[model samples]
Structure formats: C-alpha cells, structure tokens
Target: MKAKQLYTKPAIVGLTLLSSLVLSACGQSVESDGNSNNLANIKTTTLASSNLKFSEHYLTRDVRDDVFYFVMPDRFDNGDSSNDNGSKTIPESAGGFDKTSNAHYHGGDIKGLTKRLDYLKGLGISAIWLTPILRNQAVQGDSSGYHGYWPLDFTEIDPHLGTNADLKEFIDAAHDKNMKVFFDIITNHTADVIKYQECHGDGKPLFSTSKQLCEYVSLADKAAGKGYTPFIPKGHENLKTPAWLNDPKYYHNQGDSTWQGENSIYGDFMGLDDVDTDNPEVVKGMTEIFNNIISEFKPDGFRIDTVKHVNMEFWQQFTPAIIEHAKTQGIPQFFVFGEVYSGDPQELSKFTTEGDIPSVLDFAFQYRTKDVFAYEKGTDNLNDLFSYDTLYNDHNSSADYLMNFVSNHDVGRLAYTLDQSLPEASEQEKIKRFLLSNSLMYFARGIPVLYYGDEQGFTGDGGDRGAREDMMPSLTPDYNDNNLYGTDKTTADDNFDVSHPIYKKLAEYAEVYHGHEVLRKGTQKVIEHNDEPGIFAFTRTLKDHPSYTVIYNSAKSAKKFIAANAANHKVVYGEVNQQKNEFELAPLSFVIIKTI
Candidate 1:
C-alpha cells in the first residue's frame, strides 16, 4: 500500500512542489561583518527564572531542551564482526548477516554505536534513541530481525547485536560524556511464536489472503476467549524468554490486523503476535519486566514501540510505574515518549493525557510541515497543527515534550521527504529545505530528533526498508542506487563524512541550539503564516528576556515582506533574508533574530 494511503497525512509521500516555482540563488548573507559566533548570548538574568510560571512540565527543562539522534543498531556500524552472527559459529551461513539484502542484518551492533558516541555528541545530539535491541527471534521468515523489532527474548540483548555487557559499556560510555541512551522498548507484542490451529494447512481461516489471513475475531463472537486455538510450534515451545510468555492466554490470538478498528489493538501486526496489554496479569508482568530492565541497565529513557496499539489503561499504570522505578534506580528525569503515528493533535495528545505517557512522537509536526519546509504548502498548515497544542497541555505532559521529526525509520529521512516533494529540484535546493525543517524543529517548541542517516543526507527510496541505509558502508544495491545529498558517495561507501554540507550546517545549528535557553525552554508563539508558500515565522521568548523571532522563507523566490514585526531585530545566528534589513526572511532559508 502507498504511504499516503496508510498515513493520515496526505502530503507525506510523492507530493509535488507548488506549481513551477523557480530555484533562485538565496541573495546575500544577512550577517553583521560575518564574524559573530556569539553562541551564548543569553543574559545571565536571575530575574527571568524568578518570573517563570509554575508549570511542572516546564519548570525543570528536561528532554524538551534536548536534541535527539535516532539509530537502528543493525545499520549503524559493526565494531565487532565476532558478534555478527549471534552465538552461531562460522559455518552458520553468516548467521542472518546478509549485507546485500535490505531485509537481512548488516552487523551494526551496540559496540559499533558505542564507538561513534563522539560523532553523535559532536553533532549536538544530547540523547540517542536506538531501535529495539532486546533479543529478537533472528530470521523469523524471509526477512531477518535486522531492525530489532521482533522480540523472542525481552530479558537479554540479541546475540546478533551484542551481549548485555556490551550494552552496559555503551550506556556507561554515553553517560561518561554526559550524554543519554534511550532504549526503544515494546510491551505490545512479542515475536510470532504462537500459531492458530484454524489458520494451519487446509483448515482455511475465515479471511485468509495471499500474505496472511488471520481475520480479527471479537470475543463477543466467540465468548470463551481468543477466537482461534493458539498453540506453540512443536519444537519452539520454550523459544521465548521470560518463560511466562509460553502461555497462550498472555496474547490476544485474534487474527491478522488490516489495521482497522479493534484489530489495531488485538490483531497481529504483520504476523507478529500482539500481547494482551489490557489483561491485568500482562500489565503487572510488563511493568515488572521493564522495571527489572531499568534495574539492570540503568538507562535514561524509553521510546516505546506501537504505543497506540495498547489500551490506554495499560499505559496509565505502566508509564508511571516505569518512571517511579527509574527514579528509584537514580534516573530522576527519565523521559518516555510513545510512537503514535497519527497526524491529529487530539489523537497524539490522548496518549499523554489519559494514558499517562509523558509524550508521543509528533507525527503531527511532520504532517503539517512536510510541504511547508519545501514550499509545496503554505506555513498556515503549521498554524493549524499547533493551534491544538493545548490539547496536550495536561499537568504531567504537554506539547513541549513531543518528539519532533520530519524523517524516521518508518517515514524516510527529511531530505527524502523534500526530494519526494520536489523530484526535479536541485541538490542545493533540497539541502536548504532540509535545513529549513531542522531550523523550525531546533528553535521551535518540541524536541527535534535528527534521524540516524539524515546528517549524511541519506535519501533512500521511501519509508520503511528503503529509509534504512547503512552508515558504515553498504553491500546493498537498493541503498547504493539512491542519491545522497551534498556528497556523491553511495551507501556502498562509508557515510561518516563530517565535511558533508548537511552535517556541518547541523553542527552549527547544534551550537546555536545548545547556547540559547530561549530556543530550548522558551514559550513559543507562532506568528502569522503566509497564505501561499512564503515567509513562515514564530517567536521564542523566555520570561522577560529578549524574544528571538525565527523566520523561514519557504518560497522559491526571496520574500519581499514578512508578517512578523522584525524591525528592531538583529541577526544572531543566521543571515537576514532581506538584503538591507534584518526583518525579511530569505527564500528556502531561515534566520534567528534577537529583539534589540
């Protein structure tokens, strides 16, 4: 199915640029003498903190002040080939490490990620969110568990990735640098270890299709629990760790989900078994499991997987338990965000409000700005998205903590989104639009997440398997064939080139992000957006301090005027869009100005 059909946002995939906009050179630099690197311009004012509102969520400034780097372990780097194939020896046919296929593992492990901490820290990523590293079944079917989502054992790290000690070392090293490591955890489901008697062989399920046909059955239809007879595959009885998972009663055992209605919660996700999170036993067991995980690893946070699929009641109990346990484990500000792939603010905020999760991944941000960043849609779309920010403004959670990103493992990279929107656009134009997305996220309200390969400009085919590219080097033709922004090097070559345009620009953006308190913890107010693809702006201010107006020109041509009041402003980080004045926002560029 097409991404547009799957996601609520229609403009996400294959969006065209707003009719025939010309690509002009962004005029002159708007800097003053071109020698101002005053990264820390925030006045040391105790008065600002004193006048701050008593918002529990905003008082301490936690992950809201952070910039994150999201990584997939199997695609980052392979520091040790010894752990590549898990416990399987040399003759074990590369042990699922088939570098050529996008579906197979490529040997990037915790150790590889550990070795690259400097690379991440240097780029200004305060926290690292890695895809699930918990032990997977390893090669469930044709596709291997390279992405780390298929969990056979939740208690240990997958042997193909590394050992428990290797993970501890990685976290320890990250902490030593004052950086954080957040695990991508899942309570929604385990690997597809259970099979139903009704779906086997000639028995013929009620809704069997060419791919899968375990049709979703309601308990109301069959009253005596799961509609199908679920049994473990003969030899794989004890295959799953945490042993209690062996019971069929622990799972929903309904059927395959077409991702509609009740199936979204009970149905199997792409054949992976869906756990019955609503069950009291399951809730208690999952909480204890993760608590033990925190007790053992002592990591900073969790980026929960398939969050919306679980019942709200489960999260209400689970999230607070996890946080309190983490505090007991000495991680005071342990942040947790769930993955709810919806574009609606109401849908995303519900997890934070009723479910007790601190925040959910801001798919709404990506949906609203996917076009605005590239001038395909007006910035008014952003206004529409943020207009509902108060929907997330409960006492424990608010819009400030939403994990903002334009690109991700499931939705492709930022450059990929821009390139897809404007296929005929130049690489230079693509790079500017990419930076524009970063500029908004970096200086705007929520936490900005720099997708793993985005800094190196990895624009793969589109979402999912295509979006995942190897950072180390490639043996895959699908990855090698795609175009990388700024650099000619393909995925067949090492992409750790810090000299790349996107990398260097983001590094500078990081310095600016780190130095400014307003950009981090400030109250954001969106200025009026252009009706067409023109100047998009917002203001970030902390207490009584000087407010910085952030301006972005999404137009193909330079903006002649801006709606925001930028008259008494001086460029602090970027060049002004206007040739003479600091007020005008430039085309395909962004400027941050301090009110003088």
Candidate 2:
C-alpha cells in the first residue's frame, strides 16, 4: 500500500506559545545608520533578531529556515584593530602552526563583528554562527582561543575578543539587522594543554590546573570512591597526565574518552578531545556554562560542539535545562542544533531523538554530496544518499531541523577540491560549478549554511589549517597566472578577485534566496538526469506555486537536453538561449528554470 500523503494544513489546532513575539513581513528591511554604535540603541531594540519574520515553525522547535553565514571572527573583517592584544611574535603554545599565519589572531572582536552587521544584513543573512568566544588561554602564537575553540573559562568572555558589553552591543546590532546568532559552544573539552605547566615552561598552568581536572564518577556509577580520571595516551608507555585534576572547580577536564576512537564524532573534525559527558560534574558544569551563555549572550540558538562525543543521557538532562532557563528570561524561543558529525544515517538519527536535541548537522547527506561533487557523479548518489522517507518518517526530530552544507571550514574547500583534477578548468567553468553547487544548497531541503569566503570562489587544498585562510580585500598584485582559458588570475590570502564573475553571481543567488520563501520551504525532486552524458536537473515547488528546475551540464562540452512536453520555461541562472526547444548548456554550467 502507498503511504498516506501529509496534509499541508494542520489537522489539529493549537494556540501559539509566545505572545511577545512580533512577527514581521517577509520583505527585506534596511537598517538606517541611526546611532547604531551607541549602547543606548541596544535595549530599546530587540538586539539580535527583530527585522525578519519569525514563524511558529521556527519558534516551536528551534527550526531555523534562514541561510547562515558562518564567520571566523579573526579571519573576517577586523573592525576594531585597536583591540589587538596578543604578542606580535607568535607564541609556541598557540593552536596556530607555522603553515597557517592567517589562523593567527589579529584581535577581531565582538565590536568588530558588530561594526560589520550591515555587510552581513545586505547579503540577506538571517543567522550568524561565530566561532567559540569563551575565555581561552591568551598565549601569543597559541591560536587557541583566537579561533574561539580552546575554551578556558566557560563563564567569562575572552578579554582579547572584547568585553561582555561589546557582546551585548554585537547581539543588539545583529538583532537590529534582523539576524540571529548561534554561539559555537564546547562542553566537550577544555584548553588542549594536558600538562599546562610543562607546555608553558612554567610551574603554574595557564588556568587553575586542579579544577581543570575533575574526578570521574559516571552517572550510573555515582559512587564517590570510583577514583579520579586519568589522561591515558594511546599506545604510549608514559602516561602524560595532569597532576592536579582532582579538584573540580579550578580547571575543567574532558571527563572521559569516547568509546569509538576518532571517527565516532564528526569524522572530519578530530582535533577536539572527547569528554565523558556521563559524569555528573561534567553534566553540571556544562549545564551551568550553557545557562550562563543564555543569560549573558541571549543567543537565538546554540550549535553544540562535538555533541556525539557525549552520552545520550547527558543531552537528556542538559538540553531541557538550557531551554527552560532561556524561557524565563522572556527569550521564550530557544533553538539548539548539535554536531553529531557522522555520515551514517543511523548514527545521526541517534542524536536527533526526542528530548536528546532538536536538530543536528546533516553530515550523512553533506558528506554524500561532497563525495558526489568530488567524484563528478552528478545526481547519481543523491537518491540512495538522501533517505527522505527515513528522514521524514523516522522518530527523530523535525526534518526541517537538519542543517546541510556542501563545504565547511573543516573540510576541503569545494572549489579547491573540485578543481584538483580539473586544475586547468576555465574561470567560467570553475564559476559554473560553484554557482551550481550553491544553487543546490539553497534550493535543496534543510537549512543551508555558507562558509566565510565560499562566495568569492575561495580555494583551500586540504583540511583544518589548509581550509582556513585570511579573507584579503583582493588578490595580491605579485602573483599572476592564466588558466586553460587564458583568463588572467591572481592569488591573495583567500581574498576575492571581485572582477571574477562568480562573486557577482553569488550576489544574485543570495538575492534570490533572500527574496523568496519558496527556496527555503519548497519541496524538491530530481526532474531530469542523463547518466551517460553526466547531465542532471532538479525541480523545487512551493505550495501552490510555479516550480523551479535547476539543470547542470557536468560534461566538458555543451550538452542539449530534451524536455518533452515542457514549454514556456525561462532559464534564470544557467546559459540557455530563448530561441527553441533545442538549447545548449555550456560545460559545467548550471541553469535554473521557472514555468512561465
């Protein structure tokens, strides 16, 4: 028997929960420069998310439909250069290795981000997820907290990244722009220094060494005599352990190791040390930190770090407390998305169960898409990869909650990865693939997230440090090269050559996404594909509206596709002449069509 169709309208009636929510219209509203820098403008306004429309769907279960622009605070624009605090000479203890000077902190702070809210707002970005901002060890050259990941004190904001007041202003400015902020949180591990004393060449560790190390008492084995936790290095004779980890308050230690080695969590991100979320103290401290962030930052949502490393029980206890605490502050709606970073559908599904968390990064689908893009398989992998029935029918959280992206900071840049084999692919060809990938990201189901510099055709060869580069204003003057198509090119530190056609094309794509809800809320289907010639096309349809079809010519030459009985459709993003049924799609070109 065929499955029953889901009705568009709700069968049950219920009163909306938050009465204080001021729902706005769907059009774009510009924020005038009206003393935005002054703190006086903050409290008078709903500081983080006021301009855009907030639907019950989003407010109810932390479902964010808006496109997200993920920013690396230090790498993005540095608005307040005055706040540069670290030593100019890089320190040995930092997370930055010699290869990546861009990862070095240039002291980009909350004020800096706030100053550039207009830039993000103009891009039609509704959500912003900044890297971790918790207090971190401030050793020069130790790019730890500079990238916002080496968390020291969960309670305090990094002094180098500005003060609590600056954060408030940032949130306020973002709200003024109708943008939501997602705090990149880490309850998984503290600063990476195992023996801070040895690493820093000092007796005193950076932070309190004792409180950093905590006793190990499992939730099931709550017995106090279970003994202190020890850091055991794998396959090593010498156990390099922290001497004073018994005290629970002075320093925070990742409680336990994950049962599965590196790949259990997000396979791509293994730099993070796994914490035992099962310990009661671990649970308590994490809950307190989350509550503190909610009380202080008033973030629209949280992107929980390394969530799968922790036990299911920890989420069972922690998420509710965080959400409940936020509701009392009159911030009735609290959104939470966890990073379960597993490509296995079953593993990702485990983290999305009820009461566990509302949403998770769709690593399963994302990795599959990345693989398809890398392998040049067109849409061949999409069908088996995206188990829409299991996704929609399973007992996990709402399907809309999933976050999807083709490339992120942790992985190889899409442009860089795609251009590896086709190294000499023409500028137009490179731009073609980039634009097509982005169109897919936007029109596809789930919340789409764009990395910091993906819009400008940024290229990164490898993972981690390689994937991250400083966003320079433009290509540096010294280096110049021409591709197979003989187009002039220059290399800058991850800077955009705006003269490149892709940047303007990205602006158009962003405009389309920001202008229409159909891109975010529409249902999608693969309309056409030719396996032999490597051509693929898909269509997205909004409720009772005209459908939009996206076609791509993945071949090296222009290809013609015959759409039988299809008439009067205008190609928007791709190369398609208006003359007749026979139209050519340029190599690596992407086209979007809407029924006239």
Top TM-score prediction, candidate number? 1
TM-score of 2: 0.72
Model 2, runs deviating above 4 Å: 1-64, 86-103, 139-143, 193-274, 392-398, 472-500, 530-533, 560-584
Tens-digit lDDT track of model 1 for 1-596:
11110101111112111111111123423222222221112122111111212112221337776779999989999999998787663222236778999988998999999989878876777788999998886766577778888887778888888889999999988777667789999999887778887775333222232367576787676575648888776666777778888788999888788777888888888778889898899999999999999999988899999998988899999999999999888788999999998988989999999999998899989877786776478788888888898999887888888888888999877777777677766666666677778777788888888898888878888889999999998999999998777666788889876555566567656656766678877888887586688877788888878887777777766675453443555555654434334345446766676777
For model 1, the stretches where C-alpha displacement exceeds 4 angstroms are 1-61, 89-94, 201-210, 224-226, 561-567, 577-582
Cα-based TM-score, every candidate: 0.87, 0.72
Q: Which candidate number has the best lDDT?
A: 1
For candidate 2, lDDT tens digit of each residue in 53-125? 4333333423445778887776665566555563333232233322224445655567767876765654446
lDDT accuracy of residue 17 in candidate 2:
12
Superposed on all Cα atoms, the candidates' RMSDs to the truth, in angstroms, are 9.7, 12.3
Per-candidate Cα lDDT values, in order, are 0.75, 0.55
Native-to-model Cα distance after best TM-score fit, residue 348 in candidate 2, in Å: 2.0
